[model samples]
Target: MPQVFKDFAILFKYRNFLELCFAVLVSMLGFGLIIPLLPIYAREMGASGVYLGLLTSLFGMTRSITSIPGGVLADKIGRKKMMVGGLAVYTVVMFLFGVSTHLYHLLILRACQGAASGVVWPVAATAVADIVDPKDRGKAMGFFSMMWDAGIAVGPVLGGLAAAAFSMAAPFFVCSALSLASALLILKRVKETHKKSEEKPTVSLEGLSFHKLSLIGICVTGFTVSFAMGVVHPILPLFGNEVIGLNEASIGIIFGAMGVTRFLVKPISGALADNIGKKRVIVTGLAFNGVFTTLISFSESFTTIMLPSVARAVGLGMTMPSINALVTSMTTKEKRGRVMGIFSTSRNTGLVMGPLLGGFAFDALSVRAPFFICGFVVFMGALVLIATVTEVENENAEIALS
Candidate 1:
């Protein structure tokens, strides 16, 4: 425990951790708050599964599609400006999401909002990776996972309760407040990693396409599963309400528990990945996750869900950090921000798609069918990685960035 505490303290010692975490918590919390509310709001507005899937997909589609450009921008302009500016747009867009008059309008806003994420995340990741040593990427990735776990833990339950108690719109407004706070924190507390005087783009040794292959595959894996996750993020609450007859508080608790399991195991997974190897960690974790996600569709009782769903969460927690560490291991300080931006964009793009696909599945098929589809995809991703996406053996391996 003391060693754990000491390691965590070292992460805090880095200024990048402070700012990067600030951005993640604020941004992810805002997004998390809105996720549970999205289905409820859509149903109230008479949206069908297809429409909701379109909406969810629109968010992912926009984000995923723009990652390469965002990566280029991080390389060209700088990480800080891109992130701060994106957050600024994010704050405004979220407020608009709350005030949206029609589902169509909300759909458009989410797409545009996805762009902000596409821009912000990669830059933030790049900034974090910029300062850390290559050998320590596994540890740095663990810290990164903690930030996400914290956001996931707080966002859904808080948003669900707020929606239950106040209104669906309440969480968005709260998210906006947090965004404003995060923006201010970035402006004040964080120092820019790249300065104009110091900005010099260097060509990476591995070349962009090949160097980032594994990471890109990880991105695709993330996106595909997230597409499945999107189905659940919005519909699960609806399932709990309309099908299972649970209250919003109950829904929040269940989702929050998923986050808790992920949070609890995330650090351990990252550590294990560091100790073992990224490839082994990823394959095993994804396999466990894939199997359990399918089981989520079968969950009729809370007791039935406890272990299986928690197992799925643990699998997810392990898979993500290992993949991240693998990617970060190949990046360099100069190209750090841009490459990271690409990684973030890729994963979030999947996130954007998940909702749209889920929404569609809910309308066209059964509410639970998408989970099955997602599980199958997760299995395929595991197979694909095992087949093709070989992990980098050497930490000092450099990729061609230009």
Candidate 2:
């Protein structure tokens, strides 16, 4: 544990990386505020299962569409510029979310929000890749993920309380304010990490044949994992509320528990991935995550649910930083932005389908059907990873280490 803290502490010396972390941390806090509330909010506005899934899918659809372009643009323009611009748009979208009355308004706003995120997250990840060494990339990403999850851990409780004390609209307003602050912070504090690519910034994968198999494997793994998450997101809170007799506050606490477990686990998991192997950590994590995801269906009450939920967090915490590090280690700096963009696009594509299918399963099949299906899909993804991905040296890894 001390070694983990030391490794994380070592990363703080990078000023640009630290600035990015702070910006992401603040932005995610706002993003997390809505996680447990949005579907329920849509439901209250008369969204049926399919319609609810559509709302989530619209966000993924727009995000998937924009992610590649966003990555290409980041290589051409600048990471800092793209990130700030996206955050500025997010500020507007969140405020609009506060004022939205009809379900259609949310649909449009969610799409817009997705577009902005498509720009923001991939670029930020590319920047992290640019700043860190290949060997330490896992830890760096783990710390980054930890910071993001920390905000997520706290945001739900605060959002729930804010809703209880004021109104459902209150969290959106607060989210808007935080988005504006994050944008301004990035604009002022973060440095541009990459030189503009001298070659024309086309989003082709022609030159990456050496890493092609690994890239494809990672993207597939990312898509399946995200798809499983997308399947759960719109329905999990609803399951707690409608079937388990929990209130919004209790739902928020459950979400918070998941986040807290992620926060505690990610840094150590990242370090573990560095010492062992990224592929091993990812496979183990996915299987564990899949098992717990399936188990959530059997929980009768809050206490029963918490075990699986937190265990799921542990699996994810182990999985994501390793995935980020593996992806970073697969490509040269020149193509990192576009590669990250492609990966994010793939994941978003899964997200686009998962929610719609999950909602259909929830309403059309059975309420617990999404969980069972999600588990099966994710476990298959882990198997897919074992078959396709092999850890290999990036062309520039030794050079980076030197």
Candidate 3:
């Protein structure tokens, strides 16, 4: 390996990060299983469209609602212990999903699961951030994010297949088993990356509330763009079926192709974010995202969609790592968990709000409404990037050090 390549390998060689990644990947698998199954699963119990949307948003809402508290808990209790507890709760709630006979039952269970999920991700990311050197932090986080995307990608196919070949319950069962199994692995294999025994900083609601103003801007830009993009989401398969004249298989192929861009670009972008500058990567990524996102909406043919889809894929993959890495980089060791927790919460807020606005824009206007909205939002993100934030070098990470 090249010297630089060898350096990255060392970051992974630390057994604890891999343990954490394994746990996250497994948890994501369970999450992936639910994405394709949620609507149908609810419908099987007599839920209406409005009800289903509510059920869907329940998870996002809970995740958003509980994230800051989860962070506060992680900072208090420590990351590894919090992760284990969160995963255990996730497994139990998912199993409960299998036993539920009513839509409301599903909603309640899903909300609890959401709270647990909210706790796990940011804490895990912070744990990884704590252990990895600043030089390798972006690359490490990229790989972490890539694993998640890969899990979600692989999840739907397996979930859909299980739903078809065996039963709807099959996917849920598989998810539960994998998650609990991952939790055990985490408990056994992962060491505490952030030891609580260290000189723990005095917990302050004031400083611990790191990056609130910045997060507010990020959330606004995220919600505006993502909400617009989400409108096209529900319409994509519909467009393929009704207008574009494609079968389920072809639609899947196109969707899968576009999704590939996200995983492919994340790690490379992470490394780039650390190397060049976090804010620059964030701004450029959003700009690139704006162009490709526009192209995807306007694309006339399946082949044309691929062009912009690839661009959007790479853009998101790059943007996520840069944005998240930058966000994580700005805070301190003691307050890192809480900062990331709140950041993740803001993002989940966008996730819930995006679909609603996107749907309204489409039903009242046009099928392609979301794309235009997404493009506009990305432009706003670019503006936020330019006006508000400044770039900091990763190697000289003294700013983040206590």
Candidate 4:
């Protein structure tokens, strides 16, 4: 117990890392509060299956388009500036999301929110990479992952209870307030990490350079996982309510279960990746994600649903840290923001397509169909990763010592 406390003390010694964790925690908590309820809110506004999917896709599309620019700007301008500006926009947009009365209102607000998100996440991730050593990158990312998921795990349950006790709009109000608080926290507590430089970094796209191939594999893996998530996101609440006959609180509990499992698994998985090999952990995780996502289609009740949700969480927990660490390990500090931006763009590309296709699948076929397609797509992505990616061995050891 003393050793554990000492380890934590050492980890938190990086003040910027601690502050960034707080920022992510509050920001993600706000976002998480709305996750389970958003589809239901759209449904109440008379959105059909297709419209619901469009709402999510539009947000992703906007984020995807802006991510690269946001990354470049973070490198050029400053990470702290982008994060503060983005959070302010996010807070206002989330407030407006509560006031929206029509599907079109949601469409516009969600797109704005996505743009804001593009600025915040990639920049924040780059900032995290800035603070930690390459050897400790996996552990730092894991702790950061834990904080975000912990907030997500707790937020849904609270949001659901608030919605049930007051009104659907109540949770949105809470989300907006928390977002505002997070923005303020970032403004006051976080320091600028990116050193402003006049020279622009050039990223080459030619040949099968080890860096290029690893990046490609990471991006593809990101797309596949997010695609699966996007399909499930808009559909799951409705599925729970309509099929399982669950209430708002119950649906929140189900979503919370996944977050909880992710929170529990990330640290261990991250350590394993750091100690063993990133490729091994990433491949195994992707396999699990693909399998369990398919299994979700077969679930008929709340108890059964938790099985897949927990399994999917394990996969995410394993995949995210390794992917993040790999990306960080490959890039120089000067180019980290732009590279991570491209990384975000790749994941958002899946986010863009997943819902649009999932929506059509739900409307044209059945609720279960999207899950099957998502699973198959992710499995293929895993195969691509296996074929393309090789672990960075000696280079990482050198970085750790440096």
Q: Give lDDT per model, in order.
A: 0.71, 0.88, 0.69, 0.83
Q: Where does candidate 2 have its weakest 10-residue lDDT segment?
A: 393-402
137-175: candidate 3 lDDT, tens digit per residue: 778888788778777766766676666677777777778
Local accuracy of candidate 1 as per-residue lDDT tens digits, 278-397: 888888888888888788788776666556777888888888777767766655555555556566665666676676667777777887887787788788778767766666644435
Model 3: lDDT equals 0.69
Give stretches of model 2 more than 4 Å off.
395-402
The TM-scores, one per candidate, come to 0.89, 0.97, 0.84, 0.95
Off by over 4 Å in 3: 1-13, 40-52, 98-101, 197-216, 219-259, 294-308, 362-364, 393-401
lDDT of 2 by residue, 1-402 (tens): 568667867457676888888888898899888889998888889999889888999989999998999999888887999999999999999999999999999999999999999999999988988888777788888888988898888888888888878888888988999999999998998889988877787666776434688789899999999899889889998999898998888888888888999999988888888889889999989988999999999989999988899999899889988898888787778778888899899899988999999999999999999999899999989988999988866546646633
- Ranked by lDDT, top first: 2, 4, 1, 3
Quote model 4's TM-score. 0.95
lDDT of 2 at 361: 96
Q: List the residue pairs that clash in candidate 4.
A: none
Rank list by TM-score: 2, 4, 1, 3
Q: Report residue 172 deviation for candidate 4 (angstroms).
A: 0.9
Q: Which stretches of candidate 1 lie over 4 Å from their true place?
A: 195-206, 209-216, 341-356, 393-395, 398-402
